[model samples]
Target: MISWQARALNLFLKQTVKRSIENTKDVNKLRFQMRALDKFVFGTSSNIERSQSMREGTLCDEIKLKFSNSKKKLLYVHGGAFVFKTPAIHNNFIARLAEPLDLHAIVPDYPLAPEYPFPAALDSCYVIYKSLLDAGTLPEDIIIAGDSAGGNIALSLLLRARRNGLPMPNCCVLISPVADMTQSGLSSVENRYSDALFSLDVMLYCRNLYLEGANHDLHNEEISPLFADFTGLPPFMFHAGSTELMRDDSTRLAEFMQAHGVETHLQVWREMPHVFPLFEQLPESKAALQQIVDFIKKQQN
Candidate 1:
């Protein structure tokens, strides 16, 4: 059941985020608008101390959560259609995730598309992961997680790491991830009108921008990891809103992973929107987050 608060927030997002996305065609302008929306929706906060650093020459932000113990780390990739910076919602979410488990979340602000394009963001993410390994964080003690496009990068990062013979993380948690960048999934067409946060137009725009320089098939496994082999990946938990256009993205990825004999959990929340866990006001959001925490705990054990 959808809580009243969740429903209300969904409506508000339809009004603000949906409308803004529909009217904005310029990529640069959309980036600015999304950043503003992030502020408006997430509110201003000074709770988390963020520091600047360079990873493989790309600027990244390390979120210093007040409750961090550094015993465990989460490499969180932010989702803004592959362009926008890590939003305040993600910062807050990291803090919440850190509070209970004393987790430290490292957010790498990878270069965006149309400017840096496909492999740039992916390469940057890999650099960050390699740096973590070099710094002595055992792969078993690290977890990789991302939302929306970040989830795309997270999955691709795992594949890339495996191909490079790097150790796998303990697990991965994808929140409304875009596993199939081709956007050919059933929900891509079915939930087009219902998903308030994303539209097919928006998806195409981001895809084109990200895939511009690849000069290869957009469905290439490196581009749309939904096409990749996942034989040896770690356990995964995918959370998606039932109303999300990316609902099938999560479902299909889970199915593929399970087919390969990997432990996969897919949680579909009814009436929720994309990345619903960012809305901590919604009870559904809290419940979904707890599910992630539980999955992480079980993996650790």
Candidate 2:
């Protein structure tokens, strides 16, 4: 059961995020909202330590990542559609993954579009992953995870790693990922009104800003790994809400992976919205977090 507090905050976020999308005129305004959440929604246990990591002379949002001191594990990518969101705004969400699994999450605040554009965000993630590997991070211990747009980035990074013959991660997690940036999936339109935070118009605008003259090769596996060969990669577990607009992304992706003989776990939380695990203090949210942690442990075995 979802706690009353979670329900209330979910309602509040639903209203505020939807209204923000409607009221905002451009991408910068969108960033303004994420920054505002830093003071509002992003505030969590500040007892955790945070640090920075830079690559190729560009400043990236690298956190000492308080998952667990277990072993340096997981190269996490934060989802923002290559447009908005930062570690501060997403602290409330990332802290859950950090504390439970004892993971060292290296979260990078990659450059966004309408400013950096196209391969910049994707390439930024690639550079961070490569830097981590070069810095002595074992590929076997690294599990990638992302939510919404971050999920897309994580999966794309995995595909890129495979293409470059980089060792595969132990596993990966996707929370309400936007795997297909084209937004051509049925859920993108079908649930346009079902999700509270995301809107079709704004998603399309972000896509245009990011794709900015890049190859529109929709069939490219890297563009949509759901369409690519996922064999011999890490095991994966995905959480997508039944009521969320991007539900079908996970549903279809799990099916494709299993058909290709990939081990995959897919959970559909009825009535839950996108990335509901951020509210881990809530009963249902805790359950989702437990599920994720269990999946990580299973990958270890």
Candidate 3:
């Protein structure tokens, strides 16, 4: 059963967030509006110390929970439909994870879509990962995570790393990932009305913008990841709402990974919003966050 808080939030999102996304036709305007809204609703974390550095010429941000002393690192890729930067909600979420897990989190402010599409984002993330390894951070001490479009990048980064013979991270966590860019998932149609945060049209709009100057098609494994080779990737934990338009993106990818002999844990919350864990007010969000912490801990052991 969905909590009252989640139910209420869903209704609120449908009337405001969902409608706003549907009505916004200009990508730049939408990005600015969403960033402002996210800041207003979910303010940045005060408990995390933030700093910036350049990785392979691309600016990257780092966040660490105050007093965290662990050597482990979290390579978090923030999601904004491949357009926007790391919003406050993601910063708060990372703080929650970093506090309990004692992790040093690295967030890459990769180039956005419509301006720097396709290989740009993917290549930036790859260089960041390579930099981490070169700096003597053991792969086993690292955790790669992302939400929505960032999840897509996280998975694609691993595939690229594997092809280049880089060691896999300890594990990966994907929150409501957009795994299938082709929009072939059944939930994309089945849960069209159930999902309060996204509509099919909005997803297509983002995809078009993201692929505007891309050389590859939507089916390219690097872009969709649903069609990629997962032969030797690390363990994965996937979370998605059952009512999400792209719920099957997580489900199908988890199933595929399991078939490829990779360990995977998939959690589908009933009637929750897309990337529901980002809404920290929900009790369900607390539980999901705990599960992610536990998953990372288990990987370490």
Candidate 4:
């Protein structure tokens, strides 16, 4: 059953997000609306102790916690539909997930779109991963993760690394990832009204902003990891709200990976909204985080 807090959040999104998207026609105006609402959406919780800083020119936050001398680390990318900036909630969830395992989450604030465009964010992420490997961080000890657009970036980063023959991460954890920028998934249309946080119009607007008049092919594997070869990639654990518009993105990517003999697991939470794992107050979210924790631990073993 969905928690009351989730339901209330749904209602709030219906009133604020849906209404704002419905009224705003221009992409810039929509982005403005989202930015205003993002303030409330990014509020920090009392439970997590996080501090932000700049590392290798990438904005990141370190969660204050002590763990054994394990060298396990995490690269958690934040999601904002390619335009919206990272908020405190991203840091909070990363801390919650990493603190328990003594995993250090390095969240890089990659470039946003409509300004930096498609390859900019991807390039930034790739460089960060490469830097980790260069700094003697074993690829097998690092966990690459992200949610929504960030999830998309996480997958693309692996694909880029694999194509260039770089070491792969130990595992990947994705929450409601936009695996396909083409937005061709059935759930994208079917779950429009069901997904409280996203809509077809809203996604298209974000897509256009990310593309930025570039002639890039949306179906390109780098743009959409759904089209990429998953062979030799690390194991993947995907979490998505059943009602989310991007639910099929997870399913499709899972099927593709499994078909290619890659280890993959997809967990669907009933009636939950996009990236429900961020709702640390909800029981379901806690359960979901535990699932990820177990997945990562299994990778370590």
Best by lDDT: 3
Clashing residue pairs in candidate 3 (N, C-alpha, C atoms within 3 angstroms) = none
Alpha carbon lDDT of each predicted model: 0.84, 0.75, 0.88, 0.84
Write the number of the candidate with greater lDDT, choosing between 3 and 4: 3
Error of 3 at 132 (Å): 0.4
Expressed as tens digits, the lDDT of each residue in 62-153 for candidate 4 is 66355345577788888988888646567768877766777877888788887799888888888888988999999988999999999999
Off by over 4 Å in 4: 23-49, 64-70
Q: Residue 84 in model 3: shift from native, Å? A: 1.7
* Best-to-worst TM-score order: 3, 1, 4, 2
Give the worst 10-residue stretch by lDDT in candidate 2.
Answer: 60-69
Q: Give all TM-scores, in the order shown.
A: 0.94, 0.89, 0.95, 0.92
lDDT score of residue 214 within candidate 4: 78
lDDT assessment of candidate 1: 0.84
Q: Residue 265 in candidate 3 has what lDDT?
A: 99
**Clash tally for model 1:** 0
Model 2 has an lDDT value of 0.75
Instruction: Write down the RMSD of all candidates, one decimal each.
Output: 2.0, 2.5, 1.6, 2.3
Candidate achieving higher lDDT, 2 or 3: 3
